[model samples]
Target: MTANKAVGPTEAIADFVQQADFSTVPVEVRERALAAFVDTVGVAIAGHGDGGFQTLLSTMRPELPTGRATILPTGERTSAMMAALLNGGAGHALDFDDVADQIYGHPSVVLVPVVLAVAEEVGASGRDALTAYALGFEVCCAIAATMQVREHYQRGWHSTATIGVLGATAAAAHLLRLDHTRTRHALGIAASTASGSRQNFGTMTKPLHPGLAARDAVLAAKLASNGFTADPAQLEGPLGYLAMYADSADPSAVARALGNPWELARVGLNVKKYPCCYNTHRTADAILDLVRENPVRPEDIAEIRLTLEPDGFDPLIHRRPQTGLEGKFSPEYVLAAAVLDGKIALASFHDEAVLRPAAQQLLRRVSRHESAVPPIGSGEWEFAYSVVEVETTGGEVVRHRTDVPRGDCRAPLGRDDLEAKFRDCVTFAGTGLDADKLLDELWQLETTGSAGPLLNLSASS
Candidate 1:
């Protein structure tokens, strides 16, 4: 591996991937990364039944080449690229996958599926998969820190797919055991292949972004392993990835924080408790809190005013959402559901529930506004901040403000909560697998010889 000074952003990342030792990773980071893997698999199983997953399956299942990689919840063997695409799409179909704060996107949904697919293809051990995930996550955060997230995200780019492609490439390269040079080429190739648009936020296309990113990264790594050529400086060069996607590029941030404290440890993952857009989480939490404390009923509510950061409000584009999918990005519906049920679950976002006359009546009372003041002590890239005020017909006013949501790393979900979520997802997917056995296997993934058992169990009915 070359020294950091001798390389650019792309090469620096490759060098780190080639040299980083799995044993040296901290216990907490590895545990968190493993938890993310478990969470993604659970979510993917639930997502397998989604319309988006069915569409991708129908398109790619027939064309896949012979291979050993398994698509989740289906147990169908297919090419590594096809498996990654299907599994990645499934993991994100519900918008329930874990998120990284620094990346400003869902990292596990993209990285985990690709690493598992490639690891299965090459017979890599579970420990190796864990290491590759850590490397991929670190690379994603390092690269994301260098960009102006608001500017980059506001430009209509889905950072999960755009930036996640590079991270997935790094993980695939590591699992393939590529040397520094090939790893660099893999990153370069992925840069050109990376693409996703936030314009598709409320549609089935939204989940497809991470799926395509996973497929692109696997293809990039395979091509690089076969001596496919690409610009060595594709990340920082003129007309490169950063320059093309982000409003401003800072290659130095990627180099300055290569692996000092490890981004996985410093800027941790946010495992969601709800299966909806992350932007609505804080408001949902606040509304749930208000309802619990004040005994507020849906019928009693006269108006609901939610003040959120401008960037936070941008993705919630469907103010008058009609479908369950669109309701994920609609604060109006999320809040109404929260107030009506006193809890929001996977079933809450269904079209039947979202279109209920009661929920629609409450939606009319909900209104959103942009906050004039920025959140207190928020970092440059941290954007989730909201204040919820509910006015009742009984002449009562209740307000709650939340800077950090319940499932955020700051206030993370407990082990029991995580387990419950996993069970709920497995049941929801109707996979009929024994949740206890699967959970035990995932908890002991690091010591397992191969990921085949886990994948097999997940795919089994």
Candidate 2:
């Protein structure tokens, strides 16, 4: 294959489209894809009843065509695009979706939903869908690598909603097997779909961002497949995605290390154990470890202080969170719930618990500060704590710090751990989706020969 002289937006996307295929993915990548798949479905189903997600679904129901793709929680069948948007929105509804550290974004939010919807629409095998996920996952990480995502996100763009469109577009293009030109057009069209704001982080709009991005990505690809056109220089031109979105733009990074290296292999995504923002993970881990090693009763602690990276401090900066949804992003609320309740389960976010007197009292006593370096890639400098000083009124002080947080890709959860987490999520979702059969089918998806059973679980109410 001859490489293009100058990589235009469409050409760059087309190149990836031609190079990627189901057979190209390795076994490890396939396993990770399965992990992401089951995790997203579980979370989405669990959050299917959320007011924001349900409202979005209801609104979209009347506008979509009848199709094979299933609407999770309610088991309704709808067009692939509609299913993508609804499920994508629901996945992040609880704010417990996956995150990518290097990109300062959420990759699975849009990628998983879009890919799965297409899988159902095309009758793609589980193995093929998993491969599509791997391809999409790699592309998402690559764009982030080129964009200097941390800076881009800090300057106000929500990476999950913005960078995710390109990745999702790539996935849809690859699965649809569009030639390089059409693929490029899809990428170009996706540029317009890029949108999200950090101001909505603690609110319902935050989760909706990814859902809309997923739907938009499918639309972009579908339009491209139908011969719709877009700017050929949307990514590399002087006034492209970088120029328009970031403070400083680098066009070279967009195509740098295109063949020899891949960003997806280097920048591993974070699989969240707690249903809270990624910034709060390290602190929650620190508290959980402290309580475990030297178990302390709720009444024994007097005050607590949490230190975080500069970027980490901003996301969960809420002081007074009145609702359970707001409480998920509030560091104070999470810390209080973790300390007072001993476990921050799905129920921890219940309205009554969030408004509880003891949780509020602990919330008042807890304070968070900034660290020197931003905790991003590699577990080394990510989130190091000084000492969690638990000033006890009984003339004693307890201290602990997290060397490494659980579910940190480095110290990742094992198969058993993941299974437990999936079961927990399924139970909380109240979907009655068979856990054992689902896991078995997912693991043996390559030869399953039918997506109906898998789709049925998520489709039925």
Candidate 3:
């Protein structure tokens, strides 16, 4: 039970995946898993109209092999790998999926797609699917935390794509019922494809990273289940993934935290209230709060000033976004939306939204300042905090600050809010399923017989 006595990184991870199940998972951890399930499915459904997922579906449709698992946005069936690929992309296409500070990435987008796809493919029960998700999510976050994910991310590697692959693989392997040996092979196989670049952040390719991870998870798990071999040692040697990506950290330490604290509970998940890059959320929240307190007229706005810690705005790379996707990475655009549009919704990131003359005018007045404190989590605030200063043409000034957004772990969204978000997403998808009924089925996931009925109930009718 001691850290030092834990097995090698690969072995420990595989053992955890192979052994974790519904009964073994803690109640809160299972609840977190269920939240991920509900949120991811709803977001993926909302992706029906998203450009990225549409483009992907069009591009890959010709080659897709048919199977029984659901394809998320379309309700059609496809191979597990194909379903995972498309579902994952759709889940993240709108940038509305859950976020996690633990991995500094989106965990559910990748893990949920793979779990749903493989669980349906293998006839696994809803409880089993939920358990698989918990297993995968913990493994992914654990690996990223141990690997110094922030640095890995800052170096232009997308941790959601790179680190997320292992999480997807873990969940897929569990749902597929791979043994310890095969699970080790699956984990090692997954590491080989742990690739995604932050350079793709503002492009259609951005959401595709998680899609690729999801598809690869199914590939790795299915391959391993069929006796595909990989040297499980690919995770730790001098040239291994951890050594190449992480700084000084013991694998055993990472192993100890696997389920002890249950990263899902300890680290927490952020169900976003906005559909933009998480980097701009707190600032957006502050802007909305300031506006709500004293509705700031767009015409009277003289300047919008935002203060953030160093590295806080690192991921919001697009200074003046030219496209809707770029706008998601632009704090100026997001803040402008908060003021001019009075809200940030799924439509807020559209090309027309970013191109509106009013939005463009307001974006110019927005400015960002750096705080003297350390970057998020280590600084005086202990998490991402933002200060917004709005000055009017008439010299009236309004100020507001936010330490955590509404949906962040520390300030978690209530069940009603989560369900409301789900209803809105399902309504947006226009899938016609009774959002309330499907939501009830989802909430009773532990009692559902298998993934088949849920997917069937969600099927567009």
Candidate 4:
């Protein structure tokens, strides 16, 4: 009854795992591995008290003392699945995590949590975790590229929940040292575990998706490593991930650059400067540029208009956000905060701020329109000629067009900017913790033998 099909992402990635050893991995991949791991830790620390993070932690608390793994933000030990769930939720809580352009999702949201949880459970060193993480991130990106990702995501699926589940499976498989055959089983198991939706955006469920993916990945790997089996063609089969989730998928993109180290070299990872929707970044850039050039007294502006591609506007289409969480996906709310308040600080997303009269009034003056443009890939909307317009009291029009902006992979934030952002997140995390010391610990994470020091600091705070 087995129907043969071309190898899918699951099979392609499994082959690499069967043959790869620490010696064969390129040096650049090793370095990227280290960089991503550190970034994930930083974001997790900054997301400590987010409602989603706390809820996930509480849900997994019953599994504590399982003596299998360490949960970041709390040095508590738990089952590998439980640890992955908690740490993964923390990493994505702030929405300030890193993004891989090829996948158009937060790969580390699942990869780091699963790898770190498994590493700690097995007493694996930092080196092992870093190596496995690199492979996982690469696999995730390749599959996403092959999937004609934009189309897949537009259909209501969340890439981090769908693609990230596969990435987490790869990382867990690598850490568990699964053979090629068993790794395929892990991927197959993960296919069944994949689930999340874009409709959940702006709600507590959004962050929870990545956590669930991480936990599912851990469970998949453990089951596979212990001889649990699944259909080898789970990804390409009629009932598989691609067939079920995407209308069309190009398998060649997955195999084209199989061994080229594409992810580490060119895909370009972006770190977020703010914790809101990425779509709003273009407008934020333009608005900030205008603010710097002409301190438009908030009272002087008549109204503001923003134009974005349909795909870009789709995620942030919410008109009137009734809650702070909902405000995260509202372009109007984000723009209002940036222009009127002169900053989009975390406090701007609190309950009271979301319902503020001034915020709502400012939001009313602003209008968002979806442009008539075609997108090349998932999350890469038409950045060309995107404009934010401001009408002044004197009948003057002040406008800023964003081709790109700081913190984007194209116009990346420098080390100084990244440090500034980290400090800002630390401040938002509340006062008692020493921001400088925590930042230093992250900068030196690769050299640290275990995550013990970082976990200790987070727990104490």
User: lDDT for every model?
Assistant: 0.85, 0.75, 0.85, 0.75
Model 3 lDDT on a 0 to 1 scale: 0.85
Q: Choose 3 or 4, whichever is better by TM-score.
A: 3
Which ranges in model 2 have alpha carbons more than 4 Å from their true place? Answer: 1-10, 258-264, 373-387, 450-454, 458-461
State TM-scores per candidate: 0.95, 0.92, 0.95, 0.90
lDDT of 2 at 65: 88
**How do all the candidates rank in terms of TM-score, highest first?**
3, 1, 2, 4
Clash list (residue pairs), candidate 1: none
lDDT of 1: 0.85
Worst 10 residues of 3 by lDDT: 451-460
Runs with alpha carbons beyond 4 Å of true place in candidate 4: 1-6, 22-27, 372-385, 434-437, 448-455, 458-461
Q: Write the per-residue lDDT of candidate 2 for residues 20-106, one digit (tens) a residue.
A: 766766556767777777777777877866788878877877797888887765677888889888888899998777877756777
In terms of lDDT, model 2 sits at: 0.75
Error of 1 at 372 (Å): 3.9
CA deviation > 4 Å runs, candidate 1:
1-6, 374-383, 450-454, 458-460
Clashes of each: 0, 3, 0, 0
lDDT of 4 by residue, 1-461 (tens): 01133466677778765555556667767665666666677677667778877877787676566665756666567778887888788888777788776776788878988988888777666666777777777778777877777888888888988988887888888888888889989999999989888898888888888989999999999999999999987887777877887778766456554556547656567777777777677777778887889788777778888877656776674779988878888888888888878777668788689898888888888877666552222344434335788888898987777766667767777777777776776666663566677667656655557533224454445
